[model samples]
Target: MTASTSHRETTTADGRLSRYPVFLRVWASQSAGAVADQLLPVAFALYAVQRGAGAGTIAVILAGRAIALVVCLLAGGILADRVSRPRILFTADVLRAATVLGALLTLNRLPLAALGIVTALSGAAEAMSRPAMRSLIPALLPTGLLERGNALVAAVQRSATLIGALVGAAIVAAIGIRAAMGLASLLFATGAVAVLGVRDSVAGARTRTGVLADAAAGVKAIRRRPWVVAVMTAVAIQLFAGTAPTMTLLPLVATEQLGGELGYGLVLAALATGALPAIALASRWRPRRPGVVGMLALSSYAALPASLALALPLPVTAICFVIGGFAVELYFVYWLSALQRQIPAEVLGKTLALDQLSAFALLPLGYALAGPAIAAFGVQPTLLAAAGLTAAASVAALLVPGVATFSDPVGTKSDPAGG
Candidate 1:
């Protein structure tokens, strides 16, 4: 049967989720962990600044964390496919808690290098949790409700980011960064406790192959699915060309065109605000051609760069950011839902790791290059180029075979092991 017909058939009787208690507990666990993830970075940055770390040192610390996360992600994926996912989640949260509290207690007397190492460990813990978390959803919800479940998860994550940033700033201002870090540690512990209530084991069939061989199996799985490669390629391009440049330039644009930091904060808040409604829309809307619709929505992200490039008014720019945020989140919900529904359970974690790795791999390079590109080519030209590249990638993704349906009709098989 065609994918559209299959999707339509599954729509009935799955509207109301029956296994909601398990899902809710998992969601709560994820929420706590997500908030802590955001809280730590802000609190750590403030604490580092108070310790007299220069911008270069702070950049190094952030880079270390990113690198650690990237390095550990594949191992995390391999382990996730091998062990109980809930156990992985619990262990990851405990590690994060230990890392934060350990840094606070011991690293204060040492150089900031020690603190950076601790945060890098925490980032690795986060990397370990992500693929397990994403891969666990199919175990919690049936195929029909997977999209809504993913939409809700995406919404919570985005909300946690805004809440965490605001709360981190407030807590640091009120009680200091040390106290904020303590609270973040508590949050991670809370996540650890919460995830223990999730009854689903959510472990796939354990492969006896070595890590390299297992990793190669994941690559083979991806090669079997052309749509996965197509969407991931488009996402990689979007992040590298569009997202990295926009992030590098947004603050500068706000300062020059708007009124500096306050305006920058306002633009960011507006952007975040736009995603809530988009997520709500995603929960109720299930498109027949999810990949095509998602990529088209992703193309709308070009609006923000275009607005900034044209030196638009602050209100206009903020509006553009809102639209861009809305589109991106809409795309994200659908794309993630597609992954959960399409990828085989056995290799899902590895595929997710690869997807995440591809997205993060080019980000540092893009961020590093954005400044030089801006200086050499000037800001407007650079921003315009980002917009064009984002649009082009999104459109190009639609041409790949199987992308329209987001699945290969003949290649995919049922999970015999019930992973």
Candidate 2:
């Protein structure tokens, strides 16, 4: 069958994928890849602890990974725009597998510095794969299916994260850290195989240009599009403010108010669980003003830190997390859909990379401030400050004239100005 015919047959009459075989393959790859990605931090943390490394050493290793990610992600995006995404993904997976194998074999034998370098290299490979995989999605399915497709992928990622952590913990507890690394390698290899199964027909046409030029063109595109810039800026602010509380202080709140590590896991899982239903229902209901809906969804962030500080019952806290997850997922569907509609297929990868960079640029700063802020002001006050910042961000986005009212449905052509 022709590519279009096969895709049509797999989807419903509305161009929604009722049973997209290719999507299943793609999802499988993503799940395996996600498992491997999630395994890394857990494994690395355990390995560091076992090595008698201090918290400072662990921080340095993790920081190295983040720095490598920022450096490699843009190059990965440029490569994806200029070459086959599947090929890039496959290569990244192979590299990751090699890195993990090397880590497993040498972690016990090598110096701490050498192990840190290998871990950073693995993180770079994984970072390279992400933008390419994200850019590949618009080509795999029709425009009408993008929201559902994204939702499915997000759900798989969430599930894989939860499962991978448990599996990694079990492997470490049972076999050893080396065994956990071996499992990660196997997962990456499986993901590579799945990427090989994805047909080349879904790959976007390549742009003819050097890397710098291609990246520049992507920047120019964003510069010309006011709404894209605005949305990206808003997302960046939201992410920065939310990161401190979500990643750092939430654990403290759990430990101090709820219980401890167990409570932290429960809350995290609750957030993921909340997102599940949102993903399931995303495509079924189309928002008339997607941008506005997305902005409104940011309000949910206000609930999380405040609720935690109040020492709400465990059930109530979990429910709040569920609500927060649902809101975040809903907003994400709209945000990604907007990008798919606004950005051209040829440069989508670069644009997406830039978007990611913008959104996460402040994460390091947030992480840095979290500990000191909690130590100085205490968890409750710090959390309340985060909530206030998050709320202000939402309000700011809502007040932006075009952001709160823009909408572009699937298959509908959007005005370049994003009206």
Candidate 3:
């Protein structure tokens, strides 16, 4: 069947699943992929240490994944837009499976440098897969369901994060690193099969253009839309300057204040646990003004650092993290909905890619800076500074002329499919 016909058949309003089947298939695949992604790093890091690799060598291994993300992102975006998103996703999954298998087979014999190279290849495959998955959501669901769809995606991801961490650690402990990696390969293969089962409509024919031009057009579309541009800019700054500190540096805080890695994991898990309820509730409730909601949600970050600085017990710290996680999830649901509704179908892949790239581009710098900043001053003060920056970014979004007032563009527009 043609892609368009398949989409139409799957989108009936009164179906038993009510738009959830699509969400489930995508979520399951993504969750499996997330587990593999998390498992590889932990296993690889352990392998490196066991091999007597120094801190610098391990860092290089981790850094290779980040470097691949940066380099392949734009091209991935272009490919996502130019071809079938499902096809791209499946191909990326296959590549990821191969990389993991290679790692598993070569684990004991390969040098750290060679392993890093393999990990980098896996990272590139992941980079390609992410944008394609994001672009597929709008195609699979009705307009009113967009927020819920995004919420479902976010909630599943957070749950996966919790599960993946635990499962990964268990896998590493039970089997050797190579065996753990083999499990990751299985997960990726399963994800590929699930993605292949997803049904989507064919996008309209796109104009032929150079990669640079395609990328530029995607950027230009965002620039031309005041609300899109404003939200993207605000998120980029908030993620890089404010949110990263809490997330990336919290382990440091756990070590300094609570004594070690166990403390860090507990705090992190607390945050993820907190987000679960938010995601569950959000799937049923759609915010009227997403732009305004996003701004408000972001402002919640300011409280986390201030509370942590007070030297509260673990329970109190967990509560603070939960509140922060809830707020972040609220903002994220709106952000995802806004993009699905505003961006044109033909260019959605490229646009989503650009959005992902801009938001994550400074993360490496944020990670690198967190250690030095905390060392120079102190964890509490550093966190407070990060919170302040997040607040500033939120306030900046509120100042944008139309950002606070922007609504779902898809709601009022006629369906492209003429349902």
Best candidate according to lDDT: 1
Give per-residue CA lDDT, model 2, range 337-418, as digits (tens).
6676556666678888888777766665665666677678876787788778876877677555556544323344433321
TM-score of each: 0.84, 0.83, 0.81
Name the regions of candidate 3 deviating beyond 4 angstroms: 1-24, 41-66, 108-119, 170-180, 197-199, 252-262, 302-312, 407-419
Ranking by lDDT: 1, 2, 3
Model 2: lDDT equals 0.70
As for candidate 3, its clashing pairs are none
lDDT of 3 at 306: 60
Every candidate's lDDT: 0.76, 0.70, 0.69
Clashing pairs in 2: none
lDDT of 3 at 219: 75
The best candidate by TM-score is 1
Model 2 alpha-carbon miss at residue 169, Å? 4.6
Task: Flag clash pairs in model 1.
Answer: none
lDDT of 3 by residue, 316-405 (tens): 787787777777887777777766665666667777887777776765566566667767887778878877887787778777666775
Global Cα RMSD, each model: 4.3, 4.8, 5.0
Model 1, position 200, has a per-residue lDDT of: 51
